[model samples]
Target: MSQEVRTVEQQTPSNRESAQRMALRPVFMPPADIYETKDSIVVLTEMPGVSSEGVDISLERRVLTIRGHSASQDHSGYQRVYNEYTDGDYERVFTLSENIDRDRIEATLKDGVLQLVLPKAEAAKARKIELKSS
Candidate 1:
């Protein structure tokens, strides 16, 4: 239904200086599609050149975050090269409502595509109201 985009920043005592330097890397928002079913909500994100090990999915304080890092391609034999694509990291956030079951959420990455399944909470799922004849 409705979702909001959010950015999360984590600060650690040791990595504060390094984190500031790391911010120079380009951060791209990979394209994503989100759909809802009767039981869960599915999110599909296109993160080309990103592997399963390079992806991180986390949910904290009702904020779902999807982050991926794509390594740059290596052209060993070629000398001069013109490039149209840039290798960078991806980050996207979605604010979830109480309808989502945070504890049961699942994520999978395959072929540079990340899939997230957010199951609906027990009280949020639709239920049939039977009519009782008095």
Candidate 2:
């Protein structure tokens, strides 16, 4: 599979110097899956080396954002060692719709995985109506 790295410079909001100051870009996300049911939308994301308390989730104005910082290693007594992967943080954002019930969003983290459950608004849910002949 092909991979893409989006630097802070590339995703700069508007200003120039502020973009430079935000140069510490987060690493690519491991993987994610989203599914919708009759009552709610479920989102699952894979995030290794991250604790439940370390992850942060927020929903504002129909926008959902997830940001997390992984635990760093303490290399104090090691003389010389080989490393393959670098530990870093993860951040991802998603735009929600009016159908979502912003007040009832719930999130949970377990076993290096994050799961979000977003319930749909009552008016947006599908329902059946009955009619009688007059």
Candidate 3:
């Protein structure tokens, strides 16, 4: 049996323009999942070989950014015949809504995975109130 390899299309100028517009929407990059509950938003991102100290998280103008880099380990003392994963920088951004409380956002890293908890603002949170008769 024989198998064939496929190549993906390269990014062109027109595609780049479209990408810019699409970037503003809620997005998830490779190895990442985002979910929103009634109370908060959760983001789980896989960042292999990246440490808590090396990860950078920032929020600006309702846009959240995550950046990290990984370097090749010193394999001089060992030998490897097979290698597949690439060692490079990783970056992702999210367009947060006004419902999120930027001041209360928190993030944690464990075992090369990053988890972010974005709580909704008090005013933005949905609530039910009792109505009184006049």
TM-score of each: 0.77, 0.73, 0.69
lDDT string for model 2 (90-125, tens) is 666666554578788888888988999988889877
Per-residue lDDT of model 1, residues 50-84, tens digit only: 98878878777777777787876677887646878
**Stretches of model 1 off by over 4 angstroms after superposition:** 1-22
Model 3 RMSD in Å is 11.3
Ranking by lDDT: 1, 2, 3
Error of 3 at 55 (Å): 0.4
- lDDT (C-alpha) at residue 47 in model 3: 82
lDDT of 3 by residue, 12-122 (tens): 212353356345432224367777777787878788877777677877766666765554554897887777765654567766665568888989988888999988778
Point out the higher-scoring one by lDDT: 1 or 3.
Answer: 1
Off by over 4 Å in 3: 1-29
What number of backbone clashes does candidate 1 have, counting pairs of residues 3 or more apart or in separate chains? 0
Looking at model 1, report the run of 10 residues with the lowest lDDT sum.
Answer: 6-15
| TM-score, candidate number 1 | 0.77
Residue 103 of model 1 has an lDDT of 83
- Cα error, candidate 3, residue 84 (Å): 0.7
Q: Is candidate 1 or candidate 2 better by TM-score?
A: 1
Error of 2 at 48 (Å): 0.8
